[model samples]
Target: MKYTEEHEWLRSEGDVVVVGITEHATTQLGDIVFVELPEVGAEVSKDDEVVVIESVKAASDISAPLDGEIVAVNDALADNPSLANEDATGEGWFFKIKPSDASQMDDYMDEDAYKAMID
Candidate 1:
């Protein structure tokens, strides 16, 4: 898994990369109340806003972590936004993207580095 400075986490699974907000991000956002996900099959460029999350404290946009095609989105978040707080790294994942350039992942930090940055 790799983490971005924006507090998004990426996990490679087969040919797809799964994306989600880190637990620390959820903690800062307070309790999530709404989620708007990108449509599956949409092409996206790195840093493009793709997902929108609304928490009691504020609303935030989650950017595309890499240049890729959005292959799947977690529908569960739409029905129950708190899933992001309950299991951020697992069930709370936002989407799975098929990266156009896998090397784009190299720019992110590993878990230890992410922890250090957050600390």
Candidate 2:
């Protein structure tokens, strides 16, 4: 798993990459109440706003961490936004994308670096 400065975590699962906010991000966002995910098959560029999260504290947009095609989304979020708070890096994953350049992942932080940054 790799982590972006924006607090998004990416885990490569075979050919696709799974994306979700970090526990630190969830803590900052307070309790999530709403989530708006991008459509499957949408082409996205790195840094593009892809998911909208509305929490009790504030609304935030989760950006794409790499250029890719959105292949799947966690539909469960629409019904229960709190899933993000319950298991941010697991069941709360926002989307899976087939990256245009998988090497783009090399630029992100490893767990140790991410922990240092958060600390």
Could you give candidate 1's per-residue lDDT for residues 1-119 as a string of tens digits? 99999999999999999999999999999999999999999999999999999999889999999999999999998899999999999999999999999999999999999999999
Q: Distance (Å) between predicted and true CA of 35, model 2?
A: 0.4
Query: Each model's number of backbone clashes?
Result: 0, 0
lDDT of 2 by residue, 19-116 (tens): 99999999999999999999999999999999999999899999999999999999998789999999999999999999999999999999999999
Q: List the residue pairs that clash in candidate 1.
A: none
Q: TM-scores across all candidates?
A: 0.99, 0.99
Every candidate's CA RMSD = 0.4, 0.5
Q: Show model 2 residue runs off by greater than 4 Å.
A: none
Residue 72 in model 1: shift from native, Å? 0.4
